[model samples]
Target: MKKAVTILFVLVFMCGGFMQAQVVKSISLNSGMVWSTQKFDYKDINYDLPNEYLTGFHIGFAVEFLQHEYFSILTEIGYTQKGFKLEVDITTPDFPEGGLGTMEIKYSYKYAYLSPMFKVRKEFRGFIPYVFIGPRLDYLLEYPTDEFSEESAKYFNDFIFGMTYGLGLEYMFGSFGVGLIFQNQYDFTLAYHHELEEGYDSGVDIKNNAFILDLGVKFYFGKE
Candidate 1:
C-alpha cells in the first residue's frame, strides 16, 4: 500500500510539472456515460455471487501541457459513479398473471480520480486523432454501507490504483474543439478486504473496471 501510494504521487507530480516543463496548451471539460462493474476473487470456492454492470456517469476537467506539436501530457481530475447490480427472481403470488418477482441489490460507489497521461496526436486538416495511456489514482468518496456491519464496512479500501487508456477524435474549430473519447480503467488494487468477524482471513478480493465514453470540449490557451 505504501509503495502504491508513493507511485501514484510520483506520477501525479511528474505529469503536473507544468512549471519545469512546457506551456499549457488547453483546458477541457469532459462528461458522459460510464459503465462499471466489479470482479471478485473468492478464496473459498464454495462462495460466490453474481454481478452485472451498472450504467453511470462521470464529469471532469483536464489540463494539457504541450511539449511539442505531436506530444503532450494530460492531467485530469474527475468524479465518477460506478458499481454493479445483482438481481434475483423469485416466485410470488402477488402477481396475478405471472408469479415471478425480481429483487435487486444495487451497490453504488462514488469516486474522485486523478489521472496523469501521455498523449500522442496528429492533426489532419481540422480533425485530430489521439491516443493516451497513464496511471490513475482514485479515492473513494462514498460507498454503500447498508449491507454491511460497521466494523466490516471499515475494510473498504479508500485508495485505488488503476490504469487509464483511450482513443479519441476531435474537430478543431479555431481555438475551440469538440471530441469523442473512449476509455477504460482497470484497477490493480482490491476495492475491499472484506475480512469478516471470524479471525480467519478469507482474502476475498474485489476489483473495479470501467468503460467510459465522454464528449470533451476544449479551449486552447496558447499554442506551444
Candidate 2:
C-alpha cells in the first residue's frame, strides 16, 4: 500500500541521519530456534482443533549503529519459519472403516523478517549483558505447502507488522564478539480474512507468535 511505503521511507531516512551523525559499526551472523504457533480470535466462528507449537529455525545478519557499550541501534534481517500444528479427531467408520481417527496437520509459513531495535548494554571485564526492543516486519515468502492452494492464498496477507523484544549476553574476544539471545516475537494482524469481496476487516482474526533463542558471531570496529 502507498501508506505503508511512506512510513518505511520515513524510517529509513531517519536511520540514515543517525548513522551519519554517530560512529560505531558491527556486523553479525545469527541463527536460532523458533517455537511458533497461530492463535485465533473470532466473533462467530471457533476453531475446534487443538493447536500446538511448531518448531523452526531462524538465520540472519545484523548491523549495529554505535560502539558505545551503553546504547546502539541494531538492524537485522533474516529468513524464518513460523506456524502451528493442529490435531483433529474424527469418526472414521466410512473413510477408513475404523471407529475413530486422529489426524495431525502442520502449517508452516516462510518469511523474510526485519527488525530494527534499540540495544542497551553494560560491559564488565569483556562480558556484556544487554536488552533490546524493536518493531518487526515480515513479508510472506510463499503459500504454505499443506492444505493451501493458490485460491486460498489470496485471503492471506503478504506483509505483517509485529514486535520483537529480547535480552542477550555477549563476550568480547578482542575485535570479535559472541552472544546468545532470547527473543519473543508477536504479530498484530490476521492470517486469513474473508472480506476481499466485501469490505475492510474490523478486528483481529488470527495472529502468530514465537519464542526464539539465537546464537551469534559479531565483528566490530570503532570500539573502546
Candidate 3:
C-alpha cells in the first residue's frame, strides 16, 4: 500500500513538470451525477446477491494544458461518491422454519480523487468534441458504518485505484463554456482488504464500477 502511494505521488510530480512546460488553455468546474455498480465475491458463501445500480454525485475542478488544438493534458481533483447494494436470502440454523427472510445491505463510500488524463479534441463549426482516458487515485474519506455487517466492515480498504475513460462535447460562449461529459471508471484492485485464515490460502476479491454524467462550465483566461 505504501509503495503504491509513493509511486502515484511520483507520477503526479512528473506530470506537474510536464504541465509547467505547456500553455494553460482553460480551467473548468464540473458537477454531476454518478452511478455505481459493485460486485462482491464470497469465497464460501452460497447465496446469490442481486446486482444493483446505485446513484451518487461528483464535483470537481480541472486544468487543461494545451500544446495544440488536437491534444492536451487534463488534471482534475474532485469529491466523488461510490457504492453498491446487495439483496440476498439467507437460511441459518436459528431459522429452522424456512429462512430469515430477505436481507438488504447497502455500502456507500466517499472518496477524494486525483485524475490525470490525456485528451484528444477536435473543433467543429460551433462545438468541440473530446475524449479522455486516465488513471484515478482515490483515497477513502468515509465508509459505511451505520447498520453495516461486521463482515463487510472488516473488508473495506482505505485506498483504491481505478481507470476512467470518457467522451464529451463542449460549447464555448466567449470566455465561458458549458458542456456535457460522460465517464466510466473501473476499479482494478480489490475494493476491500482480504486476509487469509490459518488454513486458507487465498482471499476474496471485490470490485467497484462507476459511471458519471457531468454538466460542466469552463472559463478561459486571456482567450475569447
Candidate 4:
C-alpha cells in the first residue's frame, strides 16, 4: 500500500514537471457512474458462483498535452468505486438431503487510480469526436466484507493493473467543452487472496471488469 502511494506521488510529480516544460492544452474535471463486474475461477468447488453488475462512481482531474492537431496525451488521477454481487446456493454435510440456504453477497471496493491515455480526435464545426486507450493503475483502499459468512471475507491485492479503452464526443464552445464519454476496463490480476487448503491452490483466479459512462466538461488553458 505504501509503495503504491509512493509511486502515485512520483507520477504526479513527474507530470507536474513535464507540464511545466511543455504546453498544456487543457484541463478537465470528470465525474459519473461506473458499472462493473467480475469473472471468478473456482478450482474444486462444485457449486456455481453467479455475480451481477455493480454500480459505482468516479471523480477525476485530467491534463492534456497536445502534440498535434489530432493527437494528444492525457493523464488523469481519480477516486473510483467498483465491485460486484454474488448469489449462490450451498449444500453441506450438515444438510444431508437438501441444502442450507441461498447466499447473496455484495462485495464493494474503493480505489485511487492513475491512467495515462493516448487520444486521437477529429475536429468538426460544432463538436469533436475522440477515442482513447490507456493503462490504469489502481490502489485498493477498502477490502471485501461478507454479509453472511465471516470465513468468506477475502483479502484483495493492494495494487491492481488494468487496460482502459473508450470513445467520446465533445461539444466545444469557445474555451469550454462538454462531452459524454464511454470507457471499459479489464483487470489482469486476481481479485482476491485466498489461503490455500490441502486440495486447493494458493488462490482462485478472479478478474475485475468495468464499463463507465461519464459526462465531463473541460476548460482550456490556452489557444487550441
Best by TM-score: 1
Question: Which lDDT tens digits does candidate 2 get at residues 20-44?
Answer: 7665477788899999998866544
lDDT by residue (125-192, candidate 1, tens digit) is: 98999999999989988888787678677778889999999999999988899999999988989888
* Between candidates 1 and 4, the lDDT winner: 1
Off by over 4 Å in 2: 1-22, 46-49, 90-101, 195-204
In candidate 1, residue 67 scores what lDDT?
51
User: Which candidate achieves the best lDDT against the true structure?
Assistant: 1
Off-target runs (Cα >4 Å) in candidate 1 are 1-22, 46-48, 90-99, 196-203
lDDT of 4 by residue, 128-182 (tens): 9999999988888876653424554445677798888899999998889999989
Per-residue lDDT over 83-106 for candidate 3, one digit per residue giving the tens place of the 0 to 100 score:
887777776787756467787677
Q: What is the lDDT of residue 176 in candidate 1?
A: 92
Query: Cα deviation in Å at residue 123, candidate 1?
Result: 0.6
Q: Total backbone clashes of model 4? A: 0
Pairs clashing within candidate 3:
none
Quote the RMSD, in angstroms, for model 2.
Answer: 4.9
Best-first order by TM-score: 1, 4, 2, 3
RMSDs, each prediction?
5.0, 4.9, 4.8, 3.9
Q: Estimate each model's TM-score.
A: 0.83, 0.80, 0.78, 0.81
